[model samples]
Target: MEERIIIAGFGGQGVMAMGQLLTYSGMVEEKNVSWLPSYGPEMRGGTANCNVTISSDPVGSPVVVEATTAIVLNKPSLDKFETSVVTGGNLLINTSLIDRKSNRDDLNVYYIPANEIAIELGNVRIANMVMLGAYIEITKAISVDSVYKAFEKVFGESKAHLLPINKQALEKGAEAVKSLVNA
Candidate 1:
């Protein structure tokens, strides 16, 4: 089970966080994982993305030329990585930020209202976590339990107080995707 994932969004939107969460969660599950982050010059409000590869076997490279899944958080990201997803792969779009839908029909496309959900959850910062939850539900690439375990390591122990809310956001995202697919 090899999952090559491309997660793209504007800087400060936690694009790298999502990638890292996935990579770390994969590691917790004892899977081989690689994470490569890229971003524009500006730290915030600029283009930022990451390529994550998780598999049962050794990862040949950290770069992902073609992704098994593409999670796009904004319009520009959607435009940039929509075609990167392999046929029959998953394309999870944050509908809260991206106004349009994908033109491709070859993949399983899920439009999740990530930002809106995070806002509803009382913190817009967890929007990335929402998307991460959606991806986990769709792919089952890593267990939700692993994600919770990796949170403290990723966000650090000082911010451990935020764990409960973040966990809610992840569950909300998973619920959101389940409804989307069930519909």
Candidate 2:
């Protein structure tokens, strides 16, 4: 299956990191992957976004005009890409920053208070990881174990000490949605 995901947020919110982790995990899974980040002027607080494509076959292009899923970490990101997400696609919004919802009816939207969950998990910086977890649980793009391995690979051993916490953040995100669905 081909999956295209766009992650957008303000600078320092770990949008780029999210893309990197996804790309890394896809590679580990031996899937074709491409990560395209919007950098330079747009990254300085204006609007930061990254496109990640994971497919079983070779990826044709990295630039995504439309995506199957969008992980939006801020309101501007929600406003900017909500309308562009493919019909029947998934949108994981960081509700801590977005107060509104996409009016579209053809898509499935998830409002996850990633920042609040991350803060409760202790870092507040792992908000991206929380979103990643929700995306993984919703999309099943990669296994949870694959994500943990990717995190360890990317963060290295010294900083890898934080892997468990990051994993916990991801689990909390998944659990958050599970509760919503079960409720």
Total backbone collisions for each predicted model:
0, 0
TM-score, model 2 to reference: 0.95
Clashing pairs in model 1? none
Please give the lDDT score for candidate 2. 0.90
Per-residue error (Å), model 2, residue 142: 0.7
Which tens-of-lDDT digit does each residue in 1-183 have in candidate 1? 999999999988898988998999999999999999884475557789999999999999889988999999999999999988899999999999898989999999998999999999999999999999899999899999999999999989998999999999999999998976666
Location of the lowest summed lDDT over 10 successive residues in candidate 1: 38-47
Span of ten consecutive residues with least summed lDDT in model 2 = 38-47
TM-score of each: 0.96, 0.95
Q: Which pairs, if any, clash in model 2?
A: none
Model 2 agreement with the true structure over 4-45: per-residue lDDT tens digits: 999999999999988999999999999999999997666357
